[model samples]
Target: MTGTEPASGAAHLRWRPAPLAGLRAVAPVLVLLVALLVALAVVDPGFFDPERLLAFLRRSAPLVILAAGQYLVIVSGGFDLSVGAVVTAGVVVAAELFNLAPGLPWLVVVAVLLLGGLLVGVVNGIVSTVFAVPSFIATLGMMLVLQGAVFFWTQGAPRGYLPEDYRMLGRSAVPGAEWLPWAVVVLAVVGVAAVLFMRSDTGRTLVATGDNDVAAGLAGVRVARLRILAFALSGVAAAVAAILVGGFTGVSAQAGSGYEFQAITAVVLGGVALGGGRGSVVAAMAGAFSLQALFTLLTLLGVSGALESAVQGVIVITAVAVGGISWSRRATRTHQPVRESV
Candidate 1:
């Protein structure tokens, strides 16, 4: 009985999660987000006012959506550098389509944009997986290709305007709460979908593949398909974001410029591992909020807008460093042998 009791106690101890594991899982980005929000409130008390907050949410929605999509590709151990270009292409193509067929319905245009985005993603996935190209290079090439195509199509000056109805998704007010932006509704839908998807079996397998493709393949996960799917979802997200941006800001060649880095920065800030296999969609969204809040605070403080790029670069570098360090510490702890007293 005594021997059995000791064995049972040891088993229980081994089975229990570490005391700080829960906190650790959410700490990186969640804690930063809270801190940033508190600081924003302090800097500008009105920042938390309902109207201003809703405005902020509206402005941040597209990037938040982009971050969610980028999260999927990143967690699967791939980068989607072409998403920003995808956004630009979606907007430009929609505008061009509208110019050609002024009577075309907004919903049909949106569907076409989504399909185009998916096609772009499939190309990225195929180039990376089938052609043995690194995702970074493949996506980068895709970005350049998209940029050139848009330029050639527009002859260096984009033409056409988004229809009023098409802009509603980015600029309209909610039915019950006029103060709330329609972008908020879209953001909510995207957020919920992302959370649920991440909890699914396919999502788990995708993460496993990111962690170790060889092992995941051995376990029967369709690694290539998941990678392609990740890119496809990312493309769809960019299209959605483009629709909102086009509506809110109107058609412009540079409308979606630099969004790729922003999404990547937001994802990294959320504590998603660079090489993949770690992160939460919720945290990535929170990171997006934090980033937008930081920008707002900076603007309120009268900082030069030029510094935005520098700040983002620093955030990406710092987040990657911190994540790598944390991973190393965890790996070391996991491998360290337990010792008994003599």
Candidate 2:
């Protein structure tokens, strides 16, 4: 037995990723991030202004936060098309609540935000898990419903802007200029929580379920409940994002347009598998920052907004292919850095 222990120890060391492997996983993303920073600095040196960078983070916060939420769902074996709609729903609901009751306090508005998101999540979970609908289909339906409701409520024109105090979440930062935007801070908090969650027993069970539901069930993981929890978390994230977006940008019919796809794109870009069971929340957040940096770079380079979607489409396809097959195989076959799917 003691002799066999030596072989097992050797095997562990052999399989363990090298120190550089960590750097390799993050290298591509880091390179892109750096390239964007360099270009931004070249095109507009003011881009490096502390205030401007903080503002950019504030603006990017919603998408970044949403990407983290989307990561949880995707890594846990589900899709969440409803999040885009939920964002719109949240903004519209908050605005309407205030419009109908102009004297509504900030607390009420915050409550509305939370409640709106909870409802969407519940519906998504019930429909997806209980009705046996695919998450994609389920969320798609929710998106349409929310969109139509917004249209009907606003009649194509939104009213009741969020107050300045409420808007501070998206626009304000810590007291010191050295500190970043509040939105960025919130994102950091959520990101840290997510990372810790991933290290917990429940998180492991959830990942196990994503990897193989049938096997996890036999191992005593409540696969369905975990999936529901994942959806609920996603809905909550959307609500938080809505608060930031609406507060910062104001109420608009187009508030959450295209967010769902973008969140998915960011997740895939971070090397998280679409089908499930493989990813790090930190990497997922990095993917979000990387995407924002890419867009900022593109805009600075004079790329049309219309071209953005096309670029994103290419990214999604390329990222998935890299993570699913090419990079993964490379990561497995050699110590060379693959695509950070690890």
Candidate whose TM-score is highest: 1
Can you write out model 1's per-residue Cα lDDT over 1-342, one digit (the tens) per residue? Answer: 000112233344323224455346556777677777898898899988999999999999999999999999988888999999999998899999999999899999999998998999999988888787888889999999999999999998889989989999999997788998999999999988887787666876777888788898898888889999999999999999999999999989998998998898888787776667766777788878888877887788777889876775676577656655765766433222211000
Give the per-residue lDDT of model 2 (tens digit) for 206-298: 767776778888978877788888888889999999999888889888989989988987876776667677666666777788788778877
RMSD of 1: 8.0
lDDT of each: 0.82, 0.75
Steric overlap count per candidate: 0, 0
TM-score of 2: 0.85
TM-score for each candidate, following the candidate numbering: 0.88, 0.85
Cα lDDT of candidate 2 equals: 0.75
Best by lDDT: 1
Q: What is the lDDT of residue 46 in candidate 2?
A: 95
Question: In model 2, which regions exceed 4 Å deviation?
Answer: 1-28, 175-179, 315-326, 330-342
**Candidate 1, superposed: residue stretches over 4 Å from native:** 1-23, 315-328, 331-342
Deviation in Å, model 2, residue 60 alpha carbon:
1.5
